[model samples]
Target: MSSWNSLWKWGSVALLAYVIVRGFSTPLQPGLVESSPSRLAPGKHALTLQAVGQPFAEPDAESADFSLILRSGKELVRTDITAITPHSVEADVIIPEAVPSPAMDAFLFTPEAGTLFLGNAFFVEDAAVGPLPADLRAEAPTEVAPDLGFSFPYQPTIVESIRNLLWHVPMWFAMFFVMGIGFVASLAQLRTGLVKWDLRAEAAVRTGLVFGILGLATGSLWARFTWGAWWVSDPQLNGALVTVLLYSGYRVLRAALGEDERVGRIAAVYNVFAFVMLVILLMVLPRYTESLHPGKDGNPGFNSYDLDNSLRAVFYPAVIGWGALCYWMYTLRLRMNRVEHHLLTR
Candidate 1:
């Protein structure tokens, strides 16, 4: 156990360093973000599609190397690529007078980027709701083996915000770990009425609160960019904040009552109550109520599709790194508490 303890501090430093370097540096996969002149009519109109992700083109790129096709229902509209760049492509497409669907989806097939598709890109105006004309059909490019280098997945709403998974998720996990320690230490303090146990419990709670606050900050940042709001009315999100506030009261309670056996016992009891409230608010309420937070009801989460092996390679290490750091912080706080206790007693 002592050897493991000695190694974990070094482990925390090494793993956390790796997560910081890899998480921020990895590039994102190529994806289509916006289309210029989204509203179109039945005529030869020029269209430009804007892309945001890893560069999808080479310096020596040609129009022939790319294929731009527009879809309205089951029909595909032919388009001629007039120009291509690393970030965008310009195309000329003729929308037939009659089309099955008003909303058109665009598909850009490139040799380097493979394929980039944007749904509801263009809405047709002054066009009859009928089958697309036979003359508008176009063949898509054949699949080619393009070497898209190591990159993160490009989600429509969460393009770059996906990187927050490392900081936001692991910090929450670390908070849970630290709070669990506090809960168990509080139980031990209540049973034995030991000063050392009380010190440990207080340190754990103090360290846990730091992790919780970080979780809230990182989550807020993610919501701001991806959901377009810093704070929103969601069951799980509010539950998380309420739980953190409940834990915050523990520190406030300790500060109000100074050092004493009776006060320590009272604080331990309050600690137990706070931990229970944490579970109920964060775990129980979320299970029954509707939530807009990801991985909850009415919302989708980042699963294997979003968290590919490349992410797992770094994410797992991040969880371990953050958790170990939390433990190390708790130990430092506990030792400081012990020293202060000894000095006061002497």
Candidate 2:
């Protein structure tokens, strides 16, 4: 039983090591991130496109092996590749005199990295809406899905910051796990008025705060990368901040009422209240309001769209490993609390 009990410690250490190594080490699928001269007129012009993530072309890739196409409503306007590199492409594009729509989408066909695309990349202002001329049309090359090895999915805004899902989300999960323990221990303290139960609640809260702070820090970093702000005024984000603050009050309440005869009972009741508020702030309130978080009413979730198998392989392990580490910390704090209480009472 002792060996079995110790197994999770090693397991969590190993799993966290795997998550860190795999999550940061993986690259993203190659994609076109930006375009030059977004506003174009109906005429021949030079166009340049910038790319990110994995390399889009080989070191010695030929211009003939690349193709650039534009979609204007129903018409496909093919362009000529003037120059190409591993990271960018230059094209001499002929804007059709008449296209079905003014908004154009660009598709770059690489010899190996499949079809890279950007929606509404160009807008033609002085163009008429109609069928594209035959001279501007060309059949696009077949998509060659390159074996990109193991990599994270490429999101338009998220890009490299997508890796934070492994850290920010798992830290919150770990906080919730240990805080749930504090909730149960609080209930037990109230039911039996036991000193042990009070100690357990205090320890759980103390440990949970560590993960809660980590969650907030990591979440802020991801927000800075994706949202261009360190903090946003969204419902989900505000709720998370409030929840962390409330948990912090649990620690303050215990410290202020230090050594009182009613400290255990009073602290347990406060913990119960704080836990209830945590549920509302982080879970219930976000669902009823407009939230920027995925799976909320307005936003599309990542899991259904872009969170692929590569992400799942590391994400699940990250959740389990972080939860185990949180619990281990809680148990250590609980033991230390019991030792201190015994010494003080003697």
lDDT of 2 at 31: 85
lDDT of 1 by residue, 1-346 (tens): 9998889899999999999999899988788999989899888899999888887666354347788999889878889888877788899988888899999999888787677789999999999999877777887678666567767777888888788988999999999999999999999999999988889999999999999999999999999998899999887788889878988888788878865448788889999999998888777777678866767553335555445777888889999999999999999999999999899989
Pairs that collide, model 2: none
Q: Where's the lowest-lDDT run of ten residues in candidate 2?
A: 298-307
- Candidate 2 yields a Cα-based lDDT of 0.86
For every model shown, what is its TM-score relative to the native structure? 0.93, 0.94
Q: Which stretches of candidate 2 lie over 4 Å from their true place?
A: 59-65, 298-302
Name the 10 consecutive residues with the lowest summed lDDT in model 1: 297-306
Clashing residue pair totals per candidate (backbone < 3 A): 0, 0
Please give, for residues 1-346, the per-residue lDDT of candidate 2 as tens digits.
9997899999999999999999888888878888899999988899999988887645354346778998888778888888877789889888867778999899998777778899999999888878888888878677878667787777788888888888988899899989999999999999999999999999999888999889889989988888889999988889888888888888888789988889999999999999998888887888789877776774435455245888899999999999998889899999999999999999
Cα lDDT, model 1, residue 332: 97
